[model samples]
Target: MDDVVQAQTGTPPVRGAEIAVDGLAKHYGSLKAVDEFAINIRSGEFLALLGPSGSGKSTILMMLAGFEVPTAGRILIDGVDCTRLPPQKRNIGMVFQHYSLFPHMTVADNVAFPLKMRGVGRTERRRRAAEALKVVRLDGYGARMPSQLSGGQRQRVALARAIVYEPRLLLMDEPLSALDKNLREEMQLEIKRLHHELGITVVFVTHDQGEALTMADRVAILRGGKLQQLSPARELYERPANLFAAGFIGEMNMIPAQWDGAALTLGTGERMVPPTGAVVGTVGQGAVTLAIRPERLTVCDPVTPDALQATLREVVYAGAGTLLIAALPDGTEIRARVASASLPPALTEGETIGLSCPPEAMLVYGEEAAA
Candidate 1:
């Protein structure tokens, strides 16, 4: 923040805090909501906790916010134990999926609510509130009540209130889920810009993979209360740790097969040689799954060398790309995503065609890793 803004708000620039969650586990009777979850959040980093329903992402976030205490483990914020700290004392700004603004309060008053709670005088509160509203690009809209604003504007007000206190860390729970598609995308960029300007450590929770990929520095993938993988978005998509992660992040084609150390025998008894280190183990032989990304598979002529023959089942036209669904001799289906402009004109439904995925692009995984 610039000196002028800091002077007006009478608050120092916010510095992001590092958080270490060690052996964190939350249990509810017989159910383990979060199991042995551990991760180090870097200072000023935007980290996303992502998972499907019942995956314990919300449980972890609640534990971090002091709304729910863990059954086991510790939460350290900047090396200080905050496991039992009350929500009020944690100095963490939180924005929920719902715009939890007070309908009776004007935007400015809402933004200044935190300062009022801290016992700042009326004049100072107004000054800080105005600056906060300006920071959210609501400049002169502070006098309007929450009911009078659009959904996007209300979300902006919620964000304004979150940062108004100059909290060291920010926690967001799917804050954009309430908006329309375009508005949701717009708010994503807005939050990104705000994070850049404030440089506060942000812990975001969402089930949307696109949001996690677009907004976060690192993504934590969770399932059945256990962490599946945590990595940057690209690596998580390109080199997933297991079959569960590979199938979860995006479109993945999984083929059941038998591996004999050097080659694979598909369900149809077709033989194929895969690159070295295809599977991750010393045994290197057993029931395996050959996984390939839709974009990595190519549709080609039946005469092509090393091609897997299939009958084109359907053609799905997606803007900027086409999804080709093909059925193998054994009736196993696989899809290929190709550029719309690069697709062959002769390709059509029921056309006998050849599909080829390079040996290196095929990801081999043992069957036991299935979700």
Candidate 2:
């Protein structure tokens, strides 16, 4: 990729393009797939568009790749408008969920296919294909067919093919969704390394929270085709902007409560000090929802002073800790995580237990949190 990238003495050049999307929307008749979506992605930054099914994550990706046209708004790459640019002319590479390798072509020929489209000579295509294969660590496997390689290897070939031309941007639409747990994780690191080495801007799409949090420099969360929150993974996890974000990012126990800014009254009518936690979202008055992480809660005897009372419904032993599932008086079930060694051996289902959390471990949201 000599012509593709300029090597620095000791650092990677930012060969990626900065992108801007403003008022981007897509509509299929009455169905709005994306609504006023906007974001700014810096050069060489790895950004993940994360959301559940039908949340417009893929819609935005396709628009960026020029495979889908927007009903409204504009896309700018490197300060130039590309909203109407053809996919082939955009110089954007994409790797899909399925490894779309050519079954009839050898690995070398598949990698060289893009170059051939641009009318490169046969000799030069062969040389470039060999170099691309080496970068993906498939140097000698180039002679093999796609059917002969494992799923991971085929995916690697697809990646090499995408980066072989060193496009300014790389778009991945859940590329590891087909792999098993172990291999998916392995590929995450592999892709991250490649992004660092190649310095290419990447817009990754995934519904898996772990994958988004683990690999992205920042994550843009979406729901029902609208952007919910965009922030660094840690900020998104620890300082969620709203109830939906607080509940979606990870496992959270939302409890019904009443708050007056200084104190909180539980659903069971027990009064306690309000959460002194770092507040990130709107904390409303009257009926409210108190949110806490399962890992931050402690399970104890019902007689424990100041602890909320609950009936143990089940116990789950995870590798690092035990999960305590309990229900409050109103039948609202919640979870708590405790070190396995600390669990009371005599505790059983139907036994009354106490749940407590430090003031700083909670956040208060409106009653809509229950919905």
Candidate 3:
């Protein structure tokens, strides 16, 4: 984690190929699919628009790709207003969840489709397609038909086609959703590698938390068609802006609490201060919420100082780790994770236990009405 922070210090400034969007809004028959959305995308950076269905993540991507018109606001790429630009004119490559490859065309021909549309000569198109395939590690599979290739290979072909023209911006709409878990992880790394090796600005859209966290340099989280938070992956994970962000980013132990001027008192009568309490100020007494990640909570014998007593409700083994759902004396549930090797042997359910985490690990947020 220290290395992760140090790596941030060396991050390059926003490149010139930046994207500027302001007050972008879209609607359909009074349904606000995208509402006053705005974000600045750094050039050569891998940014992900992450949210569940109907959260307008894809709408934002479509607007940026010039497929959907925004009813309000403006879009600028490299300081040039592209609000009225056509899809093809935007020079943005798009890859969707579906392969969208031509069944009749071989991999080479499919990769060459964009080049041919751009009026490149057959010889040059073939050469460029070959180069693009090499970039995706599909060099020799050029002549193979889509039917002959596996799902992952077909997706690689789609990726190769998208990059064949060397577009300045790349737009992906859940491109790896159709693949199995193992293949999806492989492609996530591949896409990340491509983004770095090509230095192309990418605006990836996905609802998968793990996918967004693993591949994106920055994640833009949306809810109800509005931006909730935008920040680097670790920051968003460890310091979510609100309850929605806390629950969406990862597995969290959300417990009711009340905040005093100096500290937040959990339902279990345990008090903890946020990592950045100074920035958020001391939340005064009243309803509030404390967010803690499962892995942040510590479970052990001898109830360390500052630990809240709890009862071990159950322990579920998850191969790499064990998830313990425990209940505090006050009836507040907290989740804790321990390495599989460190899990207690034959621990009985409903056993009295203690759960504790460093004060800095706590995230406090004001409660909000259910949406």
Candidate 4:
């Protein structure tokens, strides 16, 4: 608990609270912003609510923080119903994408405001403020005004203020979205370190897949106000439940195919076998979509058996690897990522090639699944 201030006298350490959201729903007139949302977040775990804009992730966060009332359902924290509680009474900390620091206040004053609101003594407030600043790696900058700090520093200040009161749960709404690439990556590590040291249950909301995958213990993906899938990062990437989950979590190439229970037939009359334990919805589905990640494809000789024939169309040079764009016999584009050093020297544009994809690496979804 390095990030937490030591107990004073007889005070006990703060423990994280478990959160359970059951049938949570929000409606604005006829608009259903969030519907039938449910998940149980374990104590001391980091969970990410991931989705694109208008997917209702932000609305869910607002409801959880008690800033918005749900149209139906309930929220329980550590077995206590808090669905109707005010934000101040919930005892939860929140950090927003924009650092919502008081520009008129010094860093220390900003961090101490929460304690002051609770009517703590001045001396105790200052001591806890200093300790919180130290936890955020800004020990000597307490006297500086918010305007004097950089973006990342200001965000850290906001984080310090949110946690200074020792809240058992923390909610971050895309807190790193405003930072540059390098700084965002740096803060992600810092947030992870703080979560480990504080043992606070954190619920992070973001639209960036990379950020969610990098920092979350588990990720819940939402689309159109509905949960697409909830799983660890690796499982979400390798085994998406539907077409939207497959397309949203990472880059995927969807190929239209016909399914006949035992095998799939491509438009080019090529018969393909499904991977063992493939998640094809029922045995008798007619039209299906085959999903294969670019990284799962391998380029082979044109004459290779049991391989899809393609014509190399373009070579994209990325520093660490190369992206090969090819066209199948039916004109469907296929993409393959290969290490730069592993690319064949003789491969060139407009040359015939064979693409091999293991059945186990492929995902099949029904054609009617939401995109």
lDDT string, candidate 2, 8-28, tens digits: 233555578899999999999
Candidate with top TM-score is: 4
lDDT of 3 by residue, 82-183 (tens): 998999898888999999999999999999999889899999899888888887889799989999999999999999899888777889999999999999
Predicted candidate 4 versus true structure: per-residue lDDT over 1-371, tens digit per residue: 22385432224445688999999999989999998999999998899999999999999999999999999989999999999999999999999999888899999999999999999899989998998888889999999999999988998999999999889999999999999999899899999988877888999999999999999999999987888889999998998877888889888988888888778888888998886677544444588888899998888877888788999999999988999999989999999998888777878899999988887887778865654
Worst 10 residues of 2 by lDDT: 3-12
What is the TM-score ranking, best to worst? 4, 1, 2, 3
* Per-residue lDDT over 1-371 for candidate 1, one digit per residue giving the tens place of the 0 to 100 score: 24327534656445699999999999999999999999999998999999899999989999999999999999999999999999999989999999889889999999999989999899888987887788888999988999999999999999989988788799998899889999999899998878877788999999999999999999999999999999999988887888889889989999888989888999888889888766643335778988889899887888798888889999999889999999888899989998888888767788888888888788788866665
Candidate 2, TM-score vs. the true structure? Answer: 0.94
What's model 4's lDDT at 118?
94
What lDDT does candidate 4 reach at residue 22?
Answer: 97
Candidates in order, TM-scores: namely: 0.94, 0.94, 0.91, 0.95
Cα lDDT of candidate 2 equals 0.87
Clashes of each: 0, 0, 0, 0
Per-model CA lDDT versus the true structure: 0.88, 0.87, 0.83, 0.88
- Model 1, runs deviating above 4 Å: 1-13, 280-283
> In model 4, which range of ten residues has the least summed lDDT?
1-10
What stretches of model 2 exceed 4 Å from their correct place? 3-11, 275-278, 367-371
